[model samples]
Target: MFIRGGNMRILFVFIASILMALGGLPQQTESAKILATLSMPGRSQYIFVENYLKALAARGHQVTVINPFKNNKATPNMRFIEATKVQEYAQEMLTEMDGSNMWQEFNGYTRLMEKINSCTLDDEAVQQLLKSGETFDVVLAEMIEAPPLYGLAQHFNATLVGFSSYGTDFRIDRIMGNISPVSYNPMIIAPRTDRMSFSERLTNHYEYLLEQVHRELVHLPAMERQYKKYFPRAQKTMDEVLDSFALVLLGQHFSVSYPRPYMPNMIEVGGLHIAHKPQPLPEDIKEFIEGAQHGVIYFSMGSNVKSKDLPQETRDTLLRTFGKLKQRVLWKFEDDQLPGKPANVLIKKWYPQPDILAHSNVKIFITHGGLLSTIESLYFGKPVLGLPVLYDQHNVERARRIGFGLGLDLHQLKQEELEAAIHKLLSEPSYAKASSQISERYRDQPQPSLERAIWWTEYIIRHQGAPHLRAASRDLNYIQLHSLDTLFVLVGVPLLIVGLLLKLSCRLLRGSKPKSCPFADKQKKQ
Candidate 1:
């Protein structure tokens, strides 16, 4: 059925014309080879990142994950390079991270940053990444640990995506540039409520400013050292590389998290780890939960904090309080066994967390207020009691405010305080009601978070770096961004005019009086 030579020429021209007309449409490409790096050693955080990459791989992308966890069952499209030492160090540090005081917390922050930089610098996987000669279409590096990791994008000659599983990153916020005011956006460490008082808002604002100062003075300088060591051949400065990130996959949704203005380059995929259907719990735990005539209480401090590390008095206080409860307690106790066990409480080293939360018998949740836990508890519509010890004070505080829960300081665990909070949440119906409302709002997303993430990731590849998505604020300087200089002119111009008019008036008055000056003196003398 071959066409004649004249006819073939006409057919080619017709097809070429159609392609030219549709040139304005998106240019979709083949699956990308994505290098996704998630090196912060928290397992929950790892799960969130891994889940997204899994979705991408399922969609036919060639995904290589640089991680701290050991290899799990692998897939044809997925590969893992684990940093074992970095993994072990992070676990050890987080176990003791709930510091006793301000100095310890500040010191802990610095030491952890130092360890991350040093450990990652010596990480064998990182060395391999630099020398492997393997290329990627995109480099998605975790931004929570260190800024130097962003330089990996320059090394790969790929689009940089700053991934912060911590939900919010002030650094990335500044990088992508949005119209975020300091007044409402509290720092991760500030324990402000959803409804801030005038003084509280001021405190949050000042604390945010102080944190920015610390990042500039203490944090960035240390990260810059690693950046220099990593990508020495780059023509641009490290600051330039940091500023040029093509996308930021933030683990925050404006609906669940505080509403803030975001740029196109910043994509929020808040609940990527939440499975559509929760996996089933173990046989014994399932039976126990089913047998509970009274409701159940589930407690976990997440993977980082171990129950044994708690002070003896604190452990005693918790045990004594739980012993009297009528409801069944499912505790994620790390120990093989609790020495003084309570009849009402069941001890398991671990349980299928989401599954337990989904159970009808469960009435309340007690957690360390890891962001993942906070979000999941709400998703399941259970009132929470937050004992926030490490990392984000704001997460637990926010949970306490919105999730109909009470927050307690990890360092100051009193027996009465623990008992009262537990009793109140269990007996009161308002907490559960509040939790259900938030859950309804959260589940009302137009699409699941994972779909949005995958779409944006592929969007970056389709457009070959989507530079148009960048916020206009990224190009602005401090004076221009805040319009401080413009404000000065607005206030100063009127004052300047008044000053000039006043001077002219005084000069004219003096000139009018000058003619009588000599005669006035003579008359006075006579």
Candidate 2:
């Protein structure tokens, strides 16, 4: 009672420390052993998971990643199991995937996923890792096309954490027991804004149904084959693996993407792949960008889509259009030579995309509408003119909906149209204003996406899978999830009661009346 103020403060600190150590207060979990796999094809997909795993490793976790895309640079606390064979199959299948044809694209991806899984299991490095008798705290895997990788979690008796490079779709929504209303939540295959017209909602609902049928009839069967082939002795079945995800981190945000519902276990960590600040550009590129008398226009088709693959006519149109522009153009062309390259244009095999977008001289981005590219453009506050091809529709549609960009049909593109679109983006102040507003909202988070992703990941490990965050709806069947059975009772019971009342009234009338009506009987007697 007579202790000095300093002594009392020390005593309070001592008590708090004891409480924390004794588990009365929260404390950091010990380092974890993480087994992660990324079987998705694109470099963009790999970037999201790679950055996340790096963060986990930096936080004292030991990570082993099995991916086709290998980081040559060696780093401590992380090991790479390069499954290079996955790439061969992925590329071949990607070429066959026609984004315009729904069934064709679905079948193509289904076959591709099967081959990718088989190749992953067949890889010597992966085989050795699996047989190494290694145990892990968690297995982080891409949720989209790599369900077979879930077996690794079962093998190691670890929780499975799903990592998606895009927002949740119908398949993911169903698995996670999240509500994705068709009226507003657009299907991945059918792109639309949240505010849809009547026709758009109808189409969205139809597409959603078709997606569900495809998942059951086509996608699930393909996944089941891969699961059984690799993990025949797995403790849980394929259905169980689909349902047991501890949590999923989605690289989507409402700032650019449409607002949608998510479960407690579904975390939005959009833009985690984007650097907090752009990295330095190479000397040549920096000079080209800075030396632009007018602002520079940056064009890229992302990693999977090569600019060199464009038809000769389209290429000519682009060159001819760029030739007329006052601005300098920087294009990410895969080929070494551009036959008709414009004097105002610079072609490189690759450019540091985010760094290029970050430059003050950059005016607008002409992109293929890949999710990562869309996010990067918004992050840098640059208006876009998107030439969405294949799976690029959704991202481009979002850009158009947000008023920061415009989309052109790649198939129907003409020189006049291309020039007009580019000029519109540059001349319209509203486009730049919208881009800046969205960029501010996108960056206005309490913490960075990378940090949020890492903390949630660690939280799962600390809380032993965090089962409490999981939705109860995961246990419900389709009929139950939608309350269809409840609806049947609600409607059928009222109808049944009315039918019974009608029957009773008929019976009462029949019993109270004579064989003939009273008046008719009287008339007959008279």
Candidate 3:
């Protein structure tokens, strides 16, 4: 009986290894087809492109990437369309986030869009591809940054797939018919908690309305101009072109983000970035982490926010706060030298972030609350202390309220406040416990997220855009969607009855009014 059980276990392991090698999707039978992609909003977004595009290529799809980053090296089945020397927009955006002037932030943001448009329009690679006779089975683009790139799909007569770096924004929500209720659900970019007070709800509603108005009044017009500038020959309107997207691959799922009512055309492929096994940490880092008597704390502001760029006071406060802690600290500081360094803390310019979080001795993460880092901390069951800089980061507050972590304001940062927040996280057992439980649920899927992503991608190709998955709301206008047309009729019909009754009663009170009426007059004549 023992031998049989051992054999069974070995067989199970063998089959799992085979699946892992094939990237965990079903065995491919279809011949390779062309799948072009454009997702160069930032370095981190490009990281996602490197992940799934390679997997798609491995599954026998020919992949062509139009990105600013050079990470996706060409192969027999893969190619690159280099957008000439585009700066990483995330760094500039972070700078704007730290600024006081709202207009400055807005201008910085507008500048980013212009750069993206200019890069594609002027790039020798993109220009050649746009004018070439090449075709692709599909064209995937980043929904947030590059809506104009949808023209690539239309130009090639290929299916359109939108790749969302994080959760759905208001525009994507309206398209997919998955807009969450602001009464209970927070806005996509707003950092409000789920359970809101009356004032909070009112604020959320106002923000949602403002976002819609801005897109209609400001953003969409600019996008339409770009769309026309790029693909002048295409006949479809901008809204029509957007709705034509066959599927949207979003960074959301049950454990990492709040529940959303998604339509069939929307696919949640959260944690696809971290689906693979992490490489081992450097020997020095391994030794430092393993040698700590107490657990270690990992600090990173993600890829874009250099620790050196932080104000001197902010850096000094963090150093002092970490110095006071017994636990060892490892910071993803981009500089080789941080003067007045603490003995308890270590610094590195870059890190295998996921691998470090996987270590048992790592206690918590102090992060910028960037979506990828936020998901990884939760994915690995490590408690977090979020110092959010910008964009969808306010959702970090939800993590604190749910007992997985705590948050602090970066602009208001001080040594004592930083010290206290760390202390609270370390002392609280509930945070760690909650994180662990959630991690278990997050990994408890039937198939890996990468496999799921690959399957859906292939599914769309096989079915020629998967048209049945589109939601009815895609065809609905605001009045029809809200049933305002029905409401007006309901209200108007009742008012009409009441109005006629009032007129008839007034005629009766005036005496002999029925005889003067047209029907009464006709009956009298007969």
Candidate 4:
């Protein structure tokens, strides 16, 4: 139906008004092209990052994931590039790991970081991707140890987002410009808690200073060399690349992790990896779990640390202890054969951990206290017995502090101690109560972690890196950030003023005639 000229003008104005009103409301964002790199070796690490990437894809974003462990089946809106050399290196390093020696663990991990950076950079597929002229709206990479990977954001001319599988550490705090006060914020490797004694605080400060020096002098220099070699035409240096990160999705929830300060750009997506609906347990494992008249105690040493690597004596102690427990034991043992395996205990090379924990009959988790495993336990509302062998002590220690679990040194574990702790976790109602309370608090978020992560990622994309969220401290140096220069001015100025006043008074007193000195005159009269 054709309208009259006057009526057409009226209709156009009415349509324009409706369009203006619609524009005032929130609009749907454009689907983003996201390049996510998870270079870390552990399958556990892969799980967290993979879940996040899948969530982005589910939101209709195009995501390309580069990692050592690639999924066999590709989902819609997602592509996977396998870094095979990295996979081999990780397997070799993790297989030969000796978790009892802290120095060895540190050194091995340091070497692994070097390998991850070099291998990922040198991978044929990654090299192909580099030269393909592909563009990404955002480049998300695990920020734990691979500083060189930060260059990818610059390479793709994309917004930088850091994904921390290890949660917040001195390195993460440094990169994100979060103020980590040594007095209260203990380093991840530090054995001390947030509440520290004078000596502990000193130790914490020393640890921070030492790691800072090592990162600057040793680790980052090597990464810088790699960055220069790989992306020679890149504008920013490695250090600048580190500072350019728009957001960090941290694997920590304040409900479980240490209560510390975080910048606006630093987000906590603690249990993002946990499936909303966990998979069903295999039939045999299901029967074993269900048949336990008493509850089941699930044991695992996480992905990196193999249970079969335990010392024979330690394995024997574990076996003997499990034999005493009335509850059924499901252990993630790499080896198929346990010579003296208990009738009540079932051993497998792997188990669907989150699924196992989700079962109502699973009461206590005996874990290596890795962050992901602990977070899973918390998600499932189960108490844990942490056998922490290395850096994982921090995770277990926090659990102990929060009364969700107890930790024991894996190298120094005793059968009696193991048995007793297991009994304590099973018998004590408070531990279960704490686990339940913390789990409720953890689950009580404005939205689920995955949704929050996707929203933030897209937020950065919509705002073109969201530079406003970045901390201003990123632009400051050591003295400026700590305000040492200002502090010196504040303290030294007052001190110098007092010193000058004292000097001036002394000069006046010395130069004045004896008669003009009232105090001197009084003293003489007396």
User: In TM-score terms, which candidate is top?
Assistant: 2
Task: List CA RMSD, all candidates.
Answer: 6.1, 4.3, 7.1, 4.9
- Winner on TM-score (3 vs 4): 4
Please give the range of 10 consecutive residues that has the lowest summed lDDT in model 4: 95-104
List model 2 lDDT by residue over 1-526, tens digit each: 5999999999999999997879865457799999988776667888776678888888799998888886789978999888887676655777767656677678877887788788888899888887888899999988875678888888889999998887788778777888787888887755588889999999888877776778789988889988998887888988888888998999899888867778988889988888888788999999988999899999998888788988888899999999999999999999899997989999999888888999999999999898888899999999999998777897788788879999998878899999899999999999999999999999999999998888899899989999999888999987998899999999999999997776566557666554444444666799
After superposition, the stretches of candidate 4 with alpha carbons farther than 4 Å from their true spots are: 1-26, 91-109, 512-526
For model 4 the local lDDT of residue 393 reads 80
Which regions in candidate 2 have their CA more than 4 angstroms from the true location? 1-26, 99-101, 512-526
lDDT of 2 at 184: 85
lDDT agreement of model 2 with the native: 0.86
- Compose the digit string of candidate 1's lDDT tens values, residues 284-375: 99989999899899989887777777888888888998888888899898888888879888987878888899998999999998878877
For model 3, the local distance difference test gives 0.78
Task: Please tell me which model should have the higher lDDT, number 1 or number 2.
Answer: 2
lDDT of 4 by residue, 251-341 (tens): 8888877688989989999988988798989999999999999989999998887889889999999999999888999999998798999
Greater lDDT among 2 and 3 belongs to: 2
Please identify model 1 stretches exceeding 4 Å from their true place. 1-29, 91-107, 512-526
List the global CA lDDT of all models: 0.79, 0.86, 0.78, 0.85
Candidate 4: residue 294 Cα off by (Å): 1.1
